[model samples]
Target: MNKKKLPLKVLKALEPFVGMQGELFTIEHPGNNLLLVKDKDPNSKFYYTIEKHQIRDGKDIYSVIFAPKNDKEVGAYSTTIGADDITTTFNSWVLFLENYSKVKSFFDDPILESYQAEFFSNFEFVDEHAETNPFQTAEILQLDYLLEHVSTRLIELSDENNREANEVIVAEIAFIRESLTNRSQKWVVEQISNIYAKIAKQGVPFIKEFWAEGKKELIKIGIKALIESAQNLIS
Candidate 1:
């Protein structure tokens, strides 16, 4: 069984901006910058670390954290950026938080409540454990049926307009489907994480591959169903 590592594309996108100094600049790949947006308590968590510095001008200087964990110990490395103006740093941070928040909210779909419930039901914790394993609680086998349904619907909807974004979305869905069918647990988690990371880093181009053929009747049905569900939920 092969395990899926994190998306190299996303990590590549993050590299240039990871510890860069800028003025009036935007950090495009803000999704992986988890420290600013996520909750800090033990119950909820996000990865990464932050170090603040007092610059010569008394402004806040920041660094990026790099860490990978194993069963035995937690280790970390930090990279410091050159310098950023006050306004650019603040704006960039806010934009990063907003983007990550949106990605997080999408995973909170009403459809996932039951899957999450099932996940936590069998979730285990060791009181003496020092390192946290984020991947252990997942049970994507439960997601297969729902994911296929959503994928088919999304593919149909994309057929209607043949839009690039919809196409890529369809490919992602297929990737998830194939992973599920093969019972590739690590691949499933990696794909989901990549989806969020893509949305955070590159936005919707994450789904451009599937929309190439242009609108189909199935897609129209899917689009209608999706809209109807949205309306009913809102109502």
Candidate 2:
């Protein structure tokens, strides 16, 4: 982290939501040379960061980053436009944070999706308990992390106004969690389908694309199976 004092305007821009006191979970002003804000629930290491770069033509060029899970999006960064001036960077970041859940692209991994589709499309569904797991150790581990994030995000993103929908989704996730801990997971895909259906109907768009209409391949790789099938894919 660089040590420097931000101009008064920049300071004023960040004054409103500077900590855990706002709509976004929490933010920390580690130093004036850069501003640091975290993604919701402080869950993922992927951060919404803005920092100054030492290249200036007419204005200071700052590199802005808002990559979730450290997987950068296609148009995820407009660093040159926003970060050239701290105030602009701050404002754009606030919008991204506030609307984080609504935006699906932030979490979409095109390369992974392509791989997931291509790899698993014709793949066999072996007994997940067998040692011959079809996923690499790292990919399998990521599934665990992805499961945790998905569970937390589902609860947080549930529609409070739609009490029934919210409660139903909550209950569904709880059951799914229980299945993960226990050995009985034959119904994992079914449960996820139920959750997906509710989300689609309500238009609460967090993980809908995650389990989108035609991504049956990913659905077949049941979360429960991911747990039992924990060996290298290439073995």
Candidate 3:
């Protein structure tokens, strides 16, 4: 049996509601026992939980919890998924929603506003002569990293005669990829669908006609997710 890979999509989908303080449990991927948690800080003080255990029917049920770091708040939520849920995208999204909903406390609290200030303060040194401001710096660095990632894999797909034009698409993909990750998944999926719609208008023969472009979008979406997941550590 193959161990389930950590659901990157689920992680991203839950970001808005859960923030960086949570964990994920799975029985299908190599990293089945994935835990997404945050370090202790004044502003955002909680460790998200993702735990998996077996049910009476011999199915895996995942439970999500959020516990305050310095306080005595212990909240719990759980959901059980059957084999069918593990086999389809629908189940994946449902599972994500369950995990996300468990951490909704972060969203409901008015104190998060105060934490947001401390959140920025913790990274104050990054602003002090950091050579790159957050916007310009994160954008270029992320784009460059994205370009390198997609180029290595997609350049082989480009026609040798059209390498120049292909390079332009390559650059554009890098620019827009991060946009997907920085915002919401619904936004990113819509963006991806929209770009494909435009490419379809051009009568591109195949999905590969827009493959490189779509990938750029995906990379941006992926990286932003990764950063968001790890934000608690930085804070």
Candidate 4:
């Protein structure tokens, strides 16, 4: 196994900036500059890695690799330069993350498909461990149902005039749903607060009333901590 690794200096420099994207993606670094953002579809799961360096000619070069399971499968590589300033680096990566999540598919291009065919000549697609998607937790079944109602209402309330806020609201709902599997009361509450803040206008009352009606079901069958989190979202 030829594992591609990044230098310790690069990893340390990238830590704080990389962490900012955590809330928006299922990120896994595993002690390197390589960042893995899990796709919702298991069969089409992919990763994006960015490496920053200033090793030659006193210029910063950002090298990006978009692939499946890093070097374990085929990849697309692009190198860019002069993104040395911190602000530039931050903006570049944030844009990359947003673009990646929106486009969601790179190998659809014939060029990228050719690259994959080349790599798979000797490489096998990594059999990444299967995970239960949509993240079901028995104890949070009622809370999950409540979140579904909330998500549906959010879509109904979505406005093209407030596209970015609508996007944030949608993403926050996803964070809230994924948090249910962790069984972490604190994390779920944090996500709830996040979603509530973004949707306070037009979105809050709907959630509040929904919670009012939904809490009865929660009280009957849901986890206590989740019940409290529901209260926190409205209060």
Candidate 5:
């Protein structure tokens, strides 16, 4: 198999994480762009692949798949990133790398290994059996948009020194980061609802000024749509 070269930008972004002990390889095939990180332990490996294809709108779609080496029979988790060009593609990969590093750390720490294994198994099961495309749903797409908008506004609020709101926003950011790996619809609904409820308690005026009235309603609609969609999937 011919080894594919990763873009210079991606290689640079991954440089800090590359230690003296492991091997990094990239491969480009007709269907996918691949990056494989093989740890010192031969049994352990990390796979990151991106496949570009066209959607109904004639827009390019980049789908990312990340799978950690596990002894169990588990499939990889996948997600889509909205990217129109190479720069945006690189930025999306960098964002993914940030979360991938956190998940990778779980395997490196002895104390977290068990929990990591459990997470992998659960993730595999969900990936194998999920009937609906989590990303394709109108509700999920809306929720993703709302969360991103809120995240940006929260950063602005934080910069202004709203410490309490910043704290909550930080936690929400962490939750959103973790969800990228798990991709659980019910979990996404719960986390979004949790943040919405907490912010709601701070008063409508505060929410309006910070997150905006239109965005707030969009979140509410997104959450309700997700909850109902999940229920329909169950029945």
Candidate 6:
């Protein structure tokens, strides 16, 4: 399929969320007139696609579909807005970028969240099995390195004087380590869901503060670590 580069206007609109680093993600035309936007972050493994469709009223609309790269069973999260032409399609994308957080929350809905919980629970089993599987030795080592790196970055993000945030971070890291070590699927699933809910409800905004203050590098490190660990286990 011939790939299409992002339009200048679309890039400008996505700048606030993706930063000025244009090379950090991949943009392609995935054929059938769809534009695929994928994050280059190995940990993220998320992508968005924009397409145009016709409705019963003979009107055209532009829609954006966001989903994780590896998930095949779960349906993609999508939204559509009225658009008369390609320019309007870009405009619709801009509007979506403006309300990105709300769109993200939709993808982070309860059903998908539960799926994530179950995935992580299974991941714990993989971790345990790695101990006896010589073929998985390298991957296990990489997972350990990534988790340690992430833990250090998270600690740096936390303030020693801020008891509350520190407590959350500590609990989160502890749970991560525990889940990696334990084989209790039910408990692991619950813990994963609880931690995810907490982060969604509180962590994003909290981390945004650091991002606003030019702490994006540190934040990226922490996020990368988490993403790498997840990818490693899932792979």
Candidate with the greatest TM-score versus the true structure: 4
Model 6, 48: alpha-carbon shift in Å?
A: 46
Off by more than 4 A, model 5: 1-141, 159-161, 177-181, 209-235
Residue lDDT tens for model 1, 1-235: 1113434432343344454432212222233342232222112233344443335465434565533222233354466553443334444444543444456554454433343333223322232221222212233433544456545655565544455755675577676666454422333443443343332233344233222221232233343332342233223
Global fold similarity of model 2 (TM-score): 0.30
lDDT of 1 at 38: 25
Using lDDT as the measure, name the better of candidate 3 and candidate 4.
4
CA lDDT of each prediction against the hidden true structure: 0.38, 0.47, 0.40, 0.50, 0.45, 0.44
Task: Give residue 51's error in model 6 in angstroms.
Answer: 62
**Clashes within 3 Å, all models in order:** 17, 2, 11, 0, 2, 2
TM-score: the better of candidates 2 and 4: 4
- lDDT per residue, candidate 6, 20-114, as tens digits? 22223445334664566655432354566666443537655557676531224323567775543444544344444344433555345565455
Give residue 112's lDDT in candidate 4 (0 to 100).
33
Please, what is the TM-score per model?
0.25, 0.30, 0.22, 0.37, 0.32, 0.26
Candidate 3 per-residue lDDT over residues 196-234, each given as its tens digit: 333333334534444544345535644443243224322
- Residue-level lDDT of model 4, residues 1-235, one tens digit each, is 1133555655565566443434334444434444444433223445455654556676456565454322233355455544344345444444554555467465544443333233223222122211222223554676677667777776776677666666766776776777687523333444454454445444456556655765676565544544564455446
Q: Single out the weakest 10-residue window by summed lDDT for candidate 3.
A: 21-30
Q: Residues 72-137, candidate 2, lDDT per residue (tens digit)?
A: 452345345433356565555556565664567766545534443333333334566332123444
Which residue ranges in model 1 land beyond 4 Å of their true spot?
A: 1-141, 159-162, 181-184, 196-235
